[model samples]
Target: MLPPFTEETARLKVQLAEDAWNSKDPARVALAYAEDSEWRNRDVFLDGRDEIVGFLTGKWERELGYRLLKELWAYTGDRIAVRFEYEYHDTEGQWFRAYGNENWEFDERGLMRRRYAGINELPITADERRVAV
Candidate 1:
């Protein structure tokens, strides 16, 4: 589970992350990252777990009803690539489906040390919802 991952463990890691994020608890989700983790989520940059926590708190607050699904695209050594999608609605009741890809680098302890993500969002009607938390 640490690194140089087997296929089973890599998929497990992705599932675990999806579960944690779907919980929408910033502090809880931040535990999966290294203390000094670095992240480039979309356009914002974050350093350390504190920033991670802060960023997620804001994200969940704004992205109401956030539900996420993550799939392992590839894995080798300490690096893993993932594809993910999430659905959320804004305060104005506009629903959006977001698609993204992430590249993760983990430390020996299995904590994520670096995360890079590229995301795109499309507005959809409520009836178009395909995911639920």
Candidate 2:
């Protein structure tokens, strides 16, 4: 059986993901994965950090003005699960909230070796998604 995860580890992993997303830097985010990491995001399967970086770069380019928040769902040993919500504006200024869950498995060296993500998008009204100043 896999070992239990400490609360601290779970929190840290979530924080790392959040920071990486906020940075909007694909290269930086890709470094968090192992050299030959495997990933399935939505329906696309990608392997290796280069592909991860390329995918993220294309994603951010198309999904402009992206911002995200992730919450820890569960954890076991070196694997962690999380659910996330994100808001982004498409090329045409239409706003959407994307809800998703991810399963992540890290190797012995704390580098993520595998990731599986499921995502869906929903349209949001301007008032519903507005940020108060």
Question: Among these predicted structures, which one has the highest TM-score?
Answer: 1
lDDT of each: 0.96, 0.87
What lDDT does model 1 reach? Answer: 0.96
Per-residue lDDT of candidate 2, residues 1-133 (tens digit): 1224587877887888898988899999998899999999999999999999999999999877788888999998889999988888888888888898999998877888999999998988656674221
Q: Summarize candidate 1's per-residue lDDT along 1-133 as a digit string, tens digits.
A: 7998999999999999999999999999999999999999999999999999999999999999999999999999999999999999999999999999999999999999999999999999999999965
| Worst-scoring 10-residue span by lDDT in model 1 | 124-133
Count of clashes in candidate 2: 0
* Candidate 1 residue runs with Cα over 4 Å from true position: none
